[model samples]
Target: MIVESATGRRTPAFDTARLRTAAERSASGVTLPAVLPATALTVSSVTLTLANRAFECALPAYACSPASLPAAMPDTGWAPEGRHGLFVRNHDLYLRARDGNETVRLTSDGAEHFAYGALSGMSLMAVPLMRSQSPRPPFGITWSPDGGQFMSTRFDERKVESFPFVEAVPQDGSWRPKLWQPRIALVGDAERGDVEAAIFDVAKRSKTVIALKDGWRLYGQVFHWSADGRSAYGLVTMAALKAIGLAEIDLATGAVRIVVQEATPKWGRFNAFIYSQPNVRILEASREVLWFSERDGWGQVYFYDLGTGKLKRKLTAGQRTVRDIIGVDEKRRHLFFTAGGTDADPDPYFIRLYSTSLDGGAARLLSPETGVHLASRVPIGNAAPGSATTAALSPDGNWIVESHSALDRPPVAVLRSARDGRVVAVLETADVSRVAASGWRAPTRVKVLSADGKTPLWGTVYFPPNMRQGQKYPVIDAVYGGPQVTNAPADYREAVVTMNPRSRASLAELGFIVVMIDGRGTPGRSKAFNNESYEVFAELELADHVAGIRQLAERFGSFDLDRVGVYGHSFGGYTSARAILAYPDFYKLAVSSAGPHNFQGFYPVEGLFPAADYGDGKNIRPNPAAVPPNYARLDLMPLAPRLKGKLILVYGEMDENALPSVTLQMADALIKANKSFDLMYLPNQTHDFFRTSAYYTQRMWDYFIEHLMREEPPADFWLEIAAPSQTTGY
Candidate 1:
């Protein structure tokens, strides 16, 4: 099994003099005459760096004229021709030219909260709560193909309620608490955030607002532009998120037209957290559209007439679920996509690539490997017109590049013919010999029956590197029982398992057995599997985890069932806390971080759960005054009295996603029950408190070592966070 290992090379720390010397020795024949005295080197009207100690040639045309503009946003609002950079400051849009230091104000009517080209939405939930300066929001604008004009969304959140937050321990070293009130919409609030689309012409310096349906707002931008450049397209969804429509807007008239609309009995999803996208592709040349849906129990592709918005045919079928659209060769009428649940593979979660005709035909396999094949269609020139996470296909659409891996295997990149699933060449195989030599071992793949005793569950088992054969170790269940994603990594990646501080691998290093199971409700399977926990948040696949653990104890002699502990964050945090309360005899201890123990306080707008209980009127049931019975069943506060195992609650004081109140409420309940538990609040941190993760991880190690292992930890053992290294450098 191939495994990836670090290149083990440090970036050369070059000072200004070294940089200047390197630039002088460049192959471009650059010398002291051309090299500027400043750190930056402008060669051939482009910014070049001598950091690599090499003068690279044949760069992209855009690279020849990099923007030297002082910008507010990172990686957004750049002209299609790379001639200008766009940014929002003081709620107004400004353009900075690439060739010269010419800056122009694009809009003037923007006010404090009524802003143009502002990035504000459910996406930045933690912006208001954090103690740090509010980051400059991106100008949520889309550039025209010709780089003459751009379209942007206006953010109007002035009417939304200002949620109060206090920096108890001010970062600025203030004596008193600093109060901050940011416009944040809560459940049952009458006024929430709103958005509208508008076009800004560069030459004329004029703006035209698009006539959209009331209550409809654009999130990002009009992602697609027509071939004629006269129109653009974007997704439109209501507050309920139960339906989604592809709308086309005329550039000149600013008139909107619905290209196609799809709704589900359950709420439709535009994006599921960060794991997936809408998975919609518009074929403008052919006047056709390809969309993904789980209507047939599995995610399948369908064809529709773009102009008529009528279903033409179902392009894909069966139990296999289409994960992503890789590429489309319009001239040849070929479509490539990634999918899981092939009948031949024992593991249903293994993703594979398939190619078929856009006119509808049997899908031809493109990656026949017996593992997860991650096919990518990277953006090259004008070939693949999708984002990095959206789609990837070769320029010619003749070859498919995929990295294949399994639980115990590393990655092996292969190039296959797009016409057929033939492995034309083996590009690279990860070398883990160095890691192996250092006594590192691959995780063991484990499978067992779920709580139902019929469905199969997959997971991985991590053992201590120096484990003795005769002695059993204490088991720790590294769980994130959220339905949105699976915790178990399908391949070998440090972030997923091997070297992540919070991963099971790291836990196993402390002389404990670590296991991660993807229970019934997690995604990457059939719709039936994902819907298992639809309205029932309390269940959270804990029973399935219990069953998996019980089965593991019966099969292997290495796991100690009596000393099992559970740990997770966010939704996983709720599950980890719930594990001890529900299955006290199974999970002896639990560490929960940023768990929204009560559903009444916070609810995601993803539409996976009922939104009406919180005040949304467009859902299945709308009851704003009283806690809905469905939400009542999800509250862990009432279950606090049932806790018999050791529990510790962790939270970031400034977290907005899980709310500080949820953790405090759980603590209050435990106290009312006269229960003894540990509580910790991270100062000045938000939902993703990655900076102080090492300290928390060390505390977790101490807690597990003391409670589960029944041993004393070293006195104040400081687990210092590793300094920035080339291995994980930005």
Candidate 2:
């Protein structure tokens, strides 16, 4: 029998017809009963929900199959607002009225090479060095509070380099591949052009361009239009993002003034995880501004007098880090924010809501519970308590909509009094009866020391069902050692497999323990702790992982130190392969999918590659000689010969994030080094294996089962399900 798998891969199932034919023949030439086949076997269908979607799977009476699921969809395209909004069409910006009666084209020069909004159509398969000529639009446009005028950045990349990738199409019953080249601008490329801030007068139908001084560039989308629509504020950094400065732009004359600028020796590069985005807010009535900085070694909010261009005071000061600003009550001189690492909380990663005054007074913790608190302020002057609301601010600024949860407790939405931090009314409580009935156990949170022996590292462990005393189990280290994302869950019900529990839990069912660790260089801690990977990405990052595993094994008796496997996607994928290669004797198995193994050969952008401050303090430029060595240390190609365990590599042919070539390069290097490994390439799939994730999942399961368990998977084991009918809503 043939069955369609979740990734649409057809697999062979048990041949029921042959079984029935064999039952008809008897050894004594006597006719066997038709019920003989049914005596010991029962065929049924089970509808299982994987990744929040339902799939019908066929299984025998006593066995269950793991359902393979697809990856989450990417958030792209335009998001509209109210009656009028701006969007990109055919690479140009267009403003459309909700009634469909009026439409205006804001940009006409937009083209494939030079488009408005972020650049598109470039395949990640191409080499990044050759794609530097590709012109990209501003991160996005900032609309004024009144929506009359908007501020955007125009990226000029006509002088940048170009690269090409082949687009394959099937025509006339034959495969045809066409070459397409796109121009991209690289961070350190000398030919990369400049970006200018442009303000479009919607009513006046005119545009004003604000020019920056020489040797300066706009950092991401740091500019924002004022509420009164008279000026714009943006952060300007040197080309390499070493020295950062905040500036106020004059709308009338296109003049610019530096409000605040700081140069730090530790300004290695612009990493979203390690550093907060430039959050600048303007108060229309007071002409004051709130800006985020880490100058004092911790993320804090600072108030500045815009008129005088001088600092008023730091609104928040503590060992804790300010996460984000929720809402500002200018009338009451109050500001609400989210922070982590509170001194009173046992879990430093648990984020809480806090309220502070504009005059630099003490900050009051609004939700002081020992859990992750997500708070939203209700619209001022419309606060109605005891209503079934997701999030709302009180009219008097006394209450807020708070959703609280911990590692053990499910989420509960409640209306809490801001003054006393008391839950006034419970709006919603999560029902965990279904979870309990399913026999699913929450992973136990574990704490371990970093390689430094002083800093703390957090992780979670999932044990196999029906554990026996003194029995060791093979451990699978599900790693995502990306500096940008933290893998360990902080809130209640925030499991690593929350979206796809069966995907990870199935590994545990297969008789292996699973673990996720957020080691050093990961975000959500203090700035200094996260800077461990600054210029040293590979060694320091991997040291933490190795130390965490060893520490956990020493503490937990059930962890089998001899048998270990590691796996992850993208950045995690890079780490997985590096783990086995770097520590061949420890990690016995690895499955790395879509990893940028050859980091230096691809992109030299700010986040992709690290830069150092030479202390010249005048103009910081990328030193080509300094980057190659760092890349050499992290590149897996040189270490391919160190592979001493079972390893499988996977890549999507159409991957636009980490190009397929990056993975293929490692394969080529492994061949040259004569190293044994496995490789899989899925066609027509992008960075996320939305259509082929199930195929790879099964492959990974088989690899670990055969290599680590020393047992063979079923001859025709098939995990079948249907493709997602629609894109994921999230």
Candidate 3:
């Protein structure tokens, strides 16, 4: 049943009439939405570096020239391209002139190739020692500190592995079988081989090999350099079955040294916090190596001295994951960052700007731990109140880049004085301008007691556009449950749901509620809270989720638990699959997309273990043989059949991460057990279907609506499940 506030009353909730009009409105006026969670998970599309304005975004052109970027762009890599712009254009390298008008073509063949950072930008334009007649596509590129040199990886084909998957036909296209095999995702023999890292000297306009030792050499990946660019450091493993080594290459002296080996995880007493986002999200942090490592039991800030070729010093300690490396005030020997510790009452949304010595010492939380997440460094010059938290330090340590926002406030970018942390020039104002026309609904902050009331968990509910105070509606709980990730929306501009355009419409048009929460086990809280279910990953995570649902069920009378369905992808998928089986009565239906039916299947060849971080290379590990006598375990696949609700199991045929093979294993078990489940399979898609955001989204939304909204089995359900949908794009 749908509920609304009193007519003609001043209310923050969206009325039915207004919502209907919104759904009826065309999709254009809507803000052009984000297509996918950034593939550059480890880093963002744009980075704010020491150059102050030397922000880098992926370029699209092969012929990138310095004259292509905006004049206001900051200088980075020491040497500025003509216009000081860094970008990836058309999978190639192109430099936006300083004037930001004309673009210089850097490389000729990037059409089918993909290169990530700036070194690739300058390399495209940098004169090559020898350009192959049949040019190879660029893979990865890194520029030297001075910008005159760059390191690039050309992964030559002829020796790699590739896999293919199925696809679905679009509603507008005639049904036909289509094949999709995304490169780098599932490489075939034709695309096989290894990578080569070559340094290109822009000043000399020449290419030189730093190191070429290998069978299947993997260079160019972990790119790090000595402060002066006379030497470079990286971790490389041989092409052998299992390779491991940290090598230091002397550029000027042409010497090589092995500093470390077997860098990947092995049996050890180490701490690990895994997240889907690739790079460390901590920003505005720097000083002596400017990085963090989890090698120790804690994820701490570490300053490595390349000149000495050793860990310079342990920066920050304790259980906190040095969440964000804010900025390093080198002159003051201070590194600014954000993290959650035992110091806060609730989760420390307002991460304190911690200042510590580069050589490791006592750390202090700078922010009061009040606000939610923050934007990158604020601009320098302006002095807005509370602007200190958003301030970013300049290259010379004289100015700062300023930015700010709150859960309900949109971010504004302006310059602020570093000394006083005051705002200067305003670059952007509140941008909710688009969603504002149609009243915006802030997520209701609610606290629900855990099954063990001692641990208080929190969640947010975004009542549809215009929701009433005490309303009952169908809610879509978008679950993440992964310890390192949070599904809760933190800032105003960054919405809980990123746009796929095609699917969002159907989601709201079909009339359903959406919800996301970060229950216990999620990162950023005190270490103990984050460790509640240590050895067991999903059990407590989902329990907290179910508890939140029950609390909402009681607090908001209209929410129909009978119609509730759980869903997620990867870990999210793992969570949803478990939700249905673990709390059979709490969830009525489930839609697990690209889920793993069993952990053993995806476990590395080393085999399954209790936790990735468990074990001491010498012996003390959670080996199964020494299993505790009484352990409450969650067996999803075997237990799925016991669920008394509609179930849809989706998989991408070519998934490499949560290999489809294991999911298929579960499908077989479900069939033999005679349990009812809906299956939707994608073709040529990897476990990270993150690249194909559009279709996966539409199908997911439609699947939810078809099952949850319509609440009925489809007549063609078996037919759709019989074969792959034909129109999928890679």
Candidate 4:
């Protein structure tokens, strides 16, 4: 029920194996299965499409028609009409008819590392981290309006250096470890990968290469067709991470025209770009392009001439940040968007739906009841997962299904009028009465000042159930300090069992006051606030966390600050490990799982971390050779000598994203320093260790209880996934 981006802090799904154990102690007569069904409700409307025809049952015709609505082109090789498929095989592109067996070879030049439809560097890292079933992704293609042609990119990574991943236990049952070498363009590598785009004609069976030089890399770029389909547009970011340009491709000539370009001294990231929401859209009727930019210190929308690339006007201006362009009524010249910091709400992070004219004027608030109002509907066919902010407006752009929730509020989806924000109907309201009766408590939303005592910081606290006034509890900071995303959830899902059932609430149940903070340097705020930790990734923003906890201790007398502990995965893992090392006197213990101790050995994207204000403002440049001294300070190995608290390092032996080697380097450093620490390696597990999540959760729980609380963990209390019995309504 919460709105979050992919780059945000990771939330491990709560394992379902403990459902039986939890249900046994609940006072309410509610089963886990019963609660799940009640939370699955959406709008009472469904679209059934058969034989190229669609019917919207119990809904208006505008709800399901594509001709009347502006539909975004899918970033795949599938034809618009679904009559044929374009795919890559054996490093070359191919075309095949859906109803017939007629096949045509498009290109035969693709080979090895220079393959057609080769995954981007991010995708290459994501597949291993996600442990996807398919080793390859679909060909990223955008079909034309007529379905006669499509555009795609061919990846060139032959010049990129290769990194080996040796399988300790091969799936083929081989006695020796199998090695896999993937071409990863690490920072300082002279020859990084590039992408060459092409448009393929279905009938002519020919391809025309795009004529763009430089500024074209594989990651953070996807093509989309203009409203009229005569041209294709894409948001392109340079490899150096300092410039971004909106390029328009002429289908007939294959010439790329830069429509609008923006450069920054600091790193520029398309933080809002996704397949469902591309942050850039074309208004074909007016020959105007809608672009999202943060040049004004806040994310806002701007209008530009598509042909001349000249700024027409600023559609939005203020300290508020525009989260997404949810929908546009081109005929009416109105734009519907979601934004934060626009209203006078207690929590600045509370997002609300807004509408403003494309011609420019004051924006009118739509959902004004406070909290985070997400103007998104459940995605239908082939839509992206968690793509709630895109394609939610009904056809003709009159109605929107908005899901609203906050830290203490259960999610409720309602249908609202797009023209004037009026609630038409209440679609669903989550029933948490049973959960409340079962001793479930809502977390307290706490606001504190940053370490500087100037900027405000927000977070949440989960206390032990049935707490007494005079009792004190050990504090545990559940953190994710990655600059990419915030750690705290703004919705009622704080206690929901997602992937693994272990949550801050579950930890608090074990006699600790759990805290989740979205400290400084996280997104969803002003640009200055986000850049607080730039070039200081290794610092972990521990100063802000300490300041926040001290303020919370003064407000809540039940928090035992002396017995503080911290735990996180991925970047949070890096933070937790750094916390114990940087503030050993304050933090008693930490469980750092899969921390990127050394960024050089990690993903190639580390090149974007360094930013120095060379006076002109262009701070970020990918020059690893010039920053060897900076790397020395950023590396965690040198800080191992300062470790004084109990530290537990966990990693999946087969994790390819952070690589188990990174964790081993930390362990080796600690061993060389003659320090005592604990290490747990899960065999045959990937980055997330999905297969062994329950075991990992149990061990994490035990670590905090045994070390922080000074209590004995149950002897071999294994949380197992029990087989369903005949009476069990699973």
RMSD of each: 5.9, 14.3, 13.3, 9.2
lDDT of 1 at 145: 69
Model 4 TM-score, 2 decimals: 0.83
Write one digit per residue (lDDT tens) for candidate 1, span 230-326.
7777777765656677788888888888777777666555432225655677788888888777778777888889889999999988788888777
Q: How close is candidate 1 to the true structure, as a TM-score?
A: 0.86
Q: Write model 2 residue lDDT over 168-243, tens digit each, in one string.
A: 5422245776454555433244565546567777777667877778666666553455645677777777645556
Stretches > 4 Å off in candidate 4: 1-77, 120-137, 172-175, 214-222, 227-229, 272-276, 342-344, 377-390, 432-439, 494-502, 538-540, 606-608, 611-627, 690-692, 721-730
> Which of candidates 1 and 4 reaches a greater lDDT?
1
Writing each residue's lDDT as its tens digit, candidate 4 over 328-385 gives: 7787888888888532468867888998998989999889876888765333443322
**lDDT of predicted model 2:** 0.66
All candidates: TM-score = 0.86, 0.78, 0.62, 0.83
Assess the local accuracy of residue 254 in candidate 3 as a C-alpha lDDT between 0 and 100: 37
Error of 1 at 8 (Å): 27
Which ranking of candidates, highest TM-score first? 1, 4, 2, 3
In candidate 1, the residue pairs with backbone N, CA or C atoms under 3 Å apart (3 or more residues apart, or in different chains) clash, namely 376-392, 377-392, 377-393
Candidate 1: Cα lDDT at 404: 84
Better of 2 and 4 by TM-score: 4
